[model samples]
Target: MNEAPNRNRPAREVIAGDRRYVWHPFTQHGTEGEPTVIARAKAATLFDADGTEILDLVSSWWTCTHGHAHPKLNAALAKQAAEFEHVMFAGFTHAPAVDLAERLVRLLPGDLSRVFFSDDGSTSVEVALKIAYQYWINRGEPRRTLLLAFDGGYHGDTLGAMSVGRGSQMFKPFRDLMCQVLVLPYPATFEGDDAVEEREAGALSAFQALLAERGQSIAAMIIEPLLQGAGGMRVCRPSFLKRLVETAQAFGVIVIFDEVMTGFGRTGTLFALEQADVVPDLVCLSKGLTAGYMPMAVTVAREAIFEAFLGESFDRALPHGHSFTANPLACAVACASLDLFEEEKTLERIQAINLRHRELLAELQRRSDVTRPRVLGSIVAFDVKDIGAYQSDESRKLKAWYLAHGLNIRPLGSTLYLMPPYCITDEEMSRAYAGLIEGLDSLKR
Candidate 1:
């Protein structure tokens, strides 16, 4: 039986199908409101069914670096598809994959020269963890099996990724299944904070104490770098990061940076590491790798780490790989996106966004209802006066308020944030900030 085709379906019709068969992530269907059916999107603006416009202030969950449906990205995909769609990446090599890898190696900081392509952010982190763990085994130090992570850092959802991010309290149900990991204190700083130095010192001390205790046993230390994304936009100073890395490497621990959310010009630079002036032994990058056009991530390793895996026996090689590893289409689009970084002058755009965020923060400082105002590159975040942790009732109110005003902003508990696509205009940023001020004032009244 031939049913109605999907191409020209209405909003209600699409949502009806979704309710019957689709299971969304991090959502509750019984009590939650119906999901907005986004029919079309472009340049930081999303239109639902009936073409109602909504400004995407959260960059559609902090992706879409260049914006939605950028014509250059679309053209790149179409051109690649005409040649070929996908090819299994084992033993075989393609121009797109090789070229993208080469470009990433040159672009990334430090000696991260080897790239292992994966399907998404979670798997990219998983690859980095696995490589770090096995790197010790291949080098005859299996005793160094423990992983290190930062408290309040959320990496991804996979078992290994969840293990490192367990301190974020997002993976409580899977605690029994995940392997052991050492979590250090994260010194979360904000604007007009007087005790930031004390917090930084205490956190550094905690890292030192932990490293001293497990110095020889830790396989690797993975951090979210300068800005911890899923941790309520908790930002740390770059000097803190530099000192932290120096301390970890001194303990003979391999360092890994999970740049899943902060990479590709999110943090006022081409990469967040560039700001910290630090280079990790391993780094996982995704999200904006293809300007959010496709799901692709890479675990880049130092040349020395890659060399350690070379051996005659298959036992010494890294056995981990995804089925869609180095898909030709993703690689081609990623290359195109990287080119747009220069063509569109994305870093300059981000600087302008940062300047605007600073101006907004100045306005936010006058309000008693707002607290912990912080800005990093294209991201700006602040907390409401008296809301609880992640998944609080008050945060839901904040979210509904934004939605009512035709904005897409999903807050982390009390912390409302904006990570607008770089293509968003100055006027749009001002509107988003003004709406936020109005929302907070309404709550206060």
Candidate 2:
């Protein structure tokens, strides 16, 4: 995009166009001011139109796995585009889609063998919801209709996704329109929290109580497993997750793990499910699926769940799909991203990142201003004590301070966190943590 005038337009003109035309997500343009016009990015750094360099500590919203503009990913995308860009996946198939699905199936834990493609994370969750619901219908249990979700869990922005994620408190406007979802407590824990076990025990009791009342009527219970991304990067214990999944399954409730943000070495492993050693009936994957090179997602269903949808009539068919389902370009890049994991020992990189996070978070937590400091794989998060809502004066000040310090951090209300990509270097990590301390110091002032 550096060749033409339109491609490399001045930041002022781009900002003017954005202000006039583009309605951005999670932004109040009038007060939030001009968005940075990033011209390009590499590894863990972003280059804006004004030539300012910023470290992408949030992996560009937790998608850039290996890095931005990776060579292997670029090659895969370009090669696939020249061969076969896209084809309808309903009636036909291609190597990239099949290959990617196989790779993911092998990488994923348990008997997750069926891959249903979608455009993004939300659509992937929607697919899982429809499939999980219709699975009972096809099995002659149409009465099993109510969906379940954990408190402080977020799936996506779609209607069905929002229904399950309603407890996140970001879907107030659409509450009346969303389907009824049974909410359970999430034992959101942190480092040095001695009371987590008590909360987990209470959560288990509450979950049992809910299931006892409506277990048979519930179709599926969706959770974010170890890491809940949009719900403030809140983390829970793996032992607790394993127990939750087992309890759900014992009650015949289909469990869905929403690993859209935690998959592909984000949680110090290939998948978060590995740490829990529990398999769900359905799992939603995206964000890092194509390593931030393209928008792609898949809801991998257990063979049993998939078999329920297999019948003679189209009525039993999963009546959901995006126009670009299993887009060849995306599949190709995803396949390449998976390859990079083995070739570059990405999981090991995630381990080093995790260790670095613990070291920095320990130092950060010493400050009186920070609390509930936690680290999960490459992600580190903590709350700014005595802060208010998502759009408060404290939030604005923190955002501005981070931006001024060349750190691309978007704090979740009072919760501040980092989810840098696996390719983030030592220098970038130091700078990001330094910025974190400086921002907290400014808060003290």
Candidate 3:
């Protein structure tokens, strides 16, 4: 195979060529700034083509777990690539895929024993939705057509994902193409909020009321567990999740946990569901599944759910699969990534990061401009007051400021959040916090 002639081109020329052909995700090319050309990354820092070192505060969109260019992950990738990169996963199965599936089943909470592989977070959600829908159909209860999701919850950009996450307001143009999904008010909370319980009660009450009225029609309810990532980093109480799961399960509704963002120690645990102690009927996992090294996802379901689809005929089987389903290289990398979690004590690192976040966010909360400071595991987020929508001038200004200060921090509209890699040191975190304080102060000026 031959490589592109411009593979060795200068960064500026490469960027220029990219601008001419490539369209970036969630970016307005007409207004957004020039995309930075990243040369390499290691640990918690990204090196631009110009040799500028920028601290990765958002863990490269909250996917990176053990850090970039981890030796173990790299070795696993190289080893797998040298053996056989990929094979059609329809009838054929490989050791890497099988091993990964087994490991995931053992690691996940409750009786989540069956795994269906797909590509990326969106497809994982799509698979979960299909499984929930088909599981009901297999059980001769196809009337459960409605799917419930929380307000402001962002699953993904795919058609099915968009339908479930319709409240995110990112898919207005394609709204008509999506399936109808029921939305529930999320009991979003922050630091020092006294009305959290009241809000939780209200949400629970509303959810119970919905279940009472339309429980028989609802097929499943999907959630982002404790931390709603793209939904402005909204943090909810674990107790609320527990109650929500219990209520949904009682109504014979399948509970799907979209742990795409919260899995693999992001929420101070191996998975966010462990914090709530609630076992979801189906769990969608991606992002950190391969420690950000590969694009792979798995929707794990209960054994009983899997058993429902078992029949001799093709009609009975769940007819959903991707071309790269259970790619061997991705599976190999994911297994290695999971191994490092135990070898490197990744959960302990997350706990330390969580403690640092609380301390820094506490000080940030003192500023009148910063509101609704919240921290969970390695994540820290706060809202900026007086900033209009997600595409407001203030958000752009703050993003540029953070970039100028050697920090790769992206603000979600006015919601500034930090989710640095676990390899980040105390000093590095302090520098990020200091830059945040300076940036907030600059906004005042």
Residue 276 miss distance in model 3 (angstroms): 0.8
What is candidate 1's lDDT per residue for 1-445, written digit by digit as tens?
Answer: 2222325987788889999999999998886888888877889988777677789999877779999999999999999999999988888989999999999999987789999999899999999999999999999999999998989999999999999999889987898999999888899999888999999999999989887887889999999889999989999999999999999888889999999999999999888998889889999998999888889999999999999999899999999888899988899999999999999999999999999999999988887878999999999999887767877877787788888888888879888899999999988887898888777766666
> What local distance difference test score does each model get?
0.90, 0.89, 0.91
Q: Compute the lDDT of residue 132 as modeled in candidate 3.
A: 91
Q: Roughly what TM-score does model 2 have, to 2 decimal places?
A: 0.97
Q: Write the per-residue lDDT of candidate 2 for residues 1-445, one digit (tens) a residue.
A: 3522236567788889888889898777778776878887889988777557889998998899999999999999999999989889888999999999998898777789999999899999999999989999999999999999989899988899999999899988898999989888899999899999999999999999998988889999999989888888889999999999999999999999998998887888888999999989899999999999899999999999889878789999888877899999999999999889989999989899999998997798778888899898889999988566787898888888898888998889889999998999988898898888888778778
As a whole number from 0 to 100, the lDDT of residue 287 in candidate 1 is: 90
TM-score to native of every candidate shown: 0.97, 0.97, 0.97
Off by more than 4 A, model 1: 1-6
Candidate structures ordered by lDDT, highest first: 3, 1, 2
Write out the backbone clash pairs for model 1: none
lDDT for model 1: 0.90
Range of the 10 consecutive residues with the lowest summed lDDT in candidate 1: 1-10
